[model samples]
Target: MIKAVHGDITKLQGVSYICNAANGIGPMGGGVAAAIRKAGGKEIETEAIKVCKEQNPMPGDLYVTHAGTLPFQGIIHLVTMKQPAGPTSYDVVRTCLHNLVAYCRKQGIDKVALPALGTGVGNLDKAKVAAIFKEVLEPVKDIEFIVADIDQDFIALFA
Candidate 1:
């Protein structure tokens, strides 16, 4: 089942993973990344850097790391853009959602918490990003997905 809720992703419970809208270079600088890093602790960033060193994921790619001190078991960091210079394309957002679902299935994670990808730091359209999420995720029946965000506009799209 897919649900839209307004709350902090870091505080969400009963989720196996939380999706972080990350840059390709692995810095938790601003927006969701900053919030997650603050709540999940420095280990989250450390693990993410390790993954970046190993995988060097590009835009639209994803990398997973231990959730560190957070409640969830893992953090799935989606590289929403190659850099923070400009907005990401719809295709990049779509690819991130696809990759997230695939990773969840492979890891046997039944529940996930995700923020609005590409909407914050990426400057993509919230409704468009939400629509893409619904397009890609609504078809999958197995995983329990939560689109968690403090932004009313973003949450309203899913609602």
Candidate 2:
């Protein structure tokens, strides 16, 4: 089941993990990433950077790290752009969603919360990206997704 919720992603309950639309090199400088870093803790960013150092992630890759001070099992970083503040296309967003599903299935993760991919610094259309999320995730089985946003308008499209 995929549900849309209006609020801060960090405040979501009953979810063991949340998704972060991140860049190839992890910084968590602005937008949703920054919010997660602030609420969760700076160590979240440090852990992501440590993972990047091992193998710099490209778009469509999924990396998991400790949730720091957040109340979750882990944070799933979905690489949406090659660099911080770089542009991302609908194709890349689609690819990331597909990869996320694959990773979740492979790892047996059942529930996750995610924000609108590529709509912030990546500048992709929110509605379009939301549609892509529905297109990819609606068909998957045994997974629960919460598409969270601060904007009510963005969350409404998921209705």
**Which of the numbered candidates is closest to the native, going by highest TM-score?**
2
In Å, residue 94's CA in model 2 sits off its true spot by 0.7
TM-score (C-alpha) between model 2 and the true structure:
0.97
lDDT (tens digit, per residue) of candidate 2 on 24-131: 888999888999999999999999999998888999887888998999999999999978999889999999899988888888889989998998888888889888
Clashing pairs in 1: none
Screening candidate 2 with a backbone cut-off below 3 angstroms (N, C-alpha, C), the clashing residue pairs are: none
lDDT per model vs. reference:
0.86, 0.90
On the 0 to 100 scale, the lDDT of residue 153 in model 1 is 84
Across 52-122, the per-residue lDDT of candidate 1 in tens digits comes to: 98888898899988877787878899888866545688899899889988988998998899999888867
Give the TM-score of each candidate: 0.95, 0.97
Best by lDDT: 2
